[model samples]
Target: MLRGTAAVSVQRLAPEDLGPAAADCVFEALAARPKPVIGVATGSSPSPLYQALAASPRDFGSATWFALDEYVGLPQGHPESYAEVLRREIIEPLGLDPRTVHLPNPHTGDHQAACARYEQQIAEAGGIDLQILGIGRNGHLAFNEPGGALDSCTRLETLTEDTRSANQRFFDSPEDVPTHCLTQGLGTILAARHLLLIAQGAGKAEALRAALKGPVSRDCPASVLQLHSRVTVLADAEAASLL
Candidate 1:
């Protein structure tokens, strides 16, 4: 476990080794609860971990899943929407019940109401047991971009240009990337009992370093992880290179 100003445990590992190590965290959470509420993330960084969980023989039918964020304007079945992404990458593969999965409603006319309702749902579920996270290149967590208030709750947010550009690959063209998103805020994420952050590639190194080593500030939202008591960061060599 890391000490000093940061209250996290950092593990630097080879890219191929990240999946099993992260799976161990999920297994432990499952062992501790009959119906664990697992917070799920969508991105390339978590793909390997999801694949590892799907390949495991252990039953995951009892777990409840909540997605971290979703694009606001996308249709229900849009392939690039976070909901569809989660369904394709984890839900169907793991054979988890569709009824047990939850995500922020992107199609609602009143997005604020939807965000509030999502928060209520999480609170009713007794909060998340384990939250899997991936830091953005700009140090955002979920869609809580840089400069966002540290205590912000579940809400809608405007994505940064960098965020949109980074996500453009998922869409047919850069213009198709949604500008706004609904996300679980830094405050909401900190409510989870445990947090597991997975990052890879050299592109993530600078942000990872700032998140782990820099002062807690809105300038680098991922740096807020330093305030959490039970954060476990699993970074491949390239991501941890600056650390």
Candidate 2:
């Protein structure tokens, strides 16, 4: 998946190509380290990556995993929830023990406490080795939308109308979409040793271009990746058109 952006190694590939590419990277990372901690994102975009990892021959028995974000008030069993999606697509197929999968609990009455506890859990697991991401149409990463601070940490955030619209597919109706979320902060995400941001389809071309070619700004949260030491961006022709 690595193509044309020089700041970070960019690879352009078709939408379907995401799965095997992710599997290969996960395998390579696992082989290169001991008990690798993998941070996963939830959405339609990363489904292929999870599939590829599941189909791989490598065993993920000892690996630790963390989710990048979760809707603030959604129940764990909600079909539109990221936690449920990750459990079905990534956790189950990869043979990971459910106990090793860490996700921010939105059910807690103290939301800030949940974020702190989740951060601590990751720290105790020795931090994430690799973090997978998907760019929002508005250039957000997780729920770190426009105006997000450069050094923000894990916390609750309000979802923008654009983000809520984009995520409507997960819910029965646009109104069913949660207006807020608990997401890993820009700083928290950047702490990962490596980042793999994947995008595909003509719809993402503009955001991909902005994230790669545009100046860093809170207006485009993903643009902060430019400061990271290691980042791999994968896009399809439509998404790579700007590059």
Candidate 3:
């Protein structure tokens, strides 16, 4: 049955079983659309999904790709740079054209102007057709941290302590993590025609519960997903435990 204007489906599977399932969802979207604009999220939860896609038969030659966010102070070629990560994990592996890819430019001289241009570029491309997301331990979608405005757009946002701590693994230490980031906001994310979120492990259980079942609120940035019409949540049993 449909929930509101969109049908939300939750597929519960083992942690190892989630990659192929989510990859299948992505493949279906890509195969069904011409020049599909795909929004890619980076994280451990979606790493398996990317692996599955890399191993699949689907072709990514015709699709355009975009990354969800980037740290404010990272250098252009830093290992943790979103641009580099997308290139390594999604574009190169799939043989997709890097020229057709887009990511927020945190390294630019004028960050604010760069954000405006990024938003315009996405709009000019007809918005995103499908967006893959991973829930932060704090229920954040991309870098839309908790307590963020629900209708926010792609812009620079300060990172919360929890968010910084969670991402500290990618840096040398907590202090090495950027204090700010540029991310597509809840409104920007909801603009995508299809939204797919993947979650795994018990660490994501509480946020999964809030996003899937709790009332819509800005307190849980991901909970704003409940307002979108088309959303699919792929979760492992442990992540779905609280729900």
Best by lDDT: 1
Q: Clashes in each model (backbone N, CA, C under 3 Å)?
A: 0, 5, 0
lDDT by residue (tens digit), candidate 2, 1-243: 544445588888877886788677777778767788999998877888888887777789878899999997777688678777877997778877899888888899898999999899989999999899999999999889989898888999999999999988777888889998889999999999899888877778888888878898988998888888888887777888888
Q: Model 1 — which ten-residue stretch has the worst lDDT?
A: 1-10
In model 3, what is the error at residue 139, expressed in angstroms? 0.9
Candidate 2: worst-modelled 10 consecutive residues by lDDT = 1-10
Predictions ranked by lDDT, top down?
A: 1, 3, 2
lDDT tens digits by residue: candidate 3, 1-243: 112224578878888888998888888878777878889999788999999989987778888887888889877798988888888898888888899999988877888888888889899888898899999998999999888799988999999999889888999877789999899888999999999999999999999888878888988888877888888888888888887
How far is each candidate from the true structure, as Cα RMSD in Å? Answer: 1.3, 1.5, 2.0
List per-prediction Cα lDDT, in the order shown.
Answer: 0.92, 0.85, 0.86
Error of 3 at 186 (Å): 0.6
Deviation of model 3 at 6, angstroms: 7.0
Per-residue CA lDDT of model 1 for 177-230, tens digit only, reads 999999999999999999999999999999998988988899999998988989
TM-score of each: 0.97, 0.96, 0.95
Q: Worst lDDT window (10 residues) for model 3?
A: 1-10
Question: What TM-score does candidate 1 get on C-alpha atoms?
Answer: 0.97
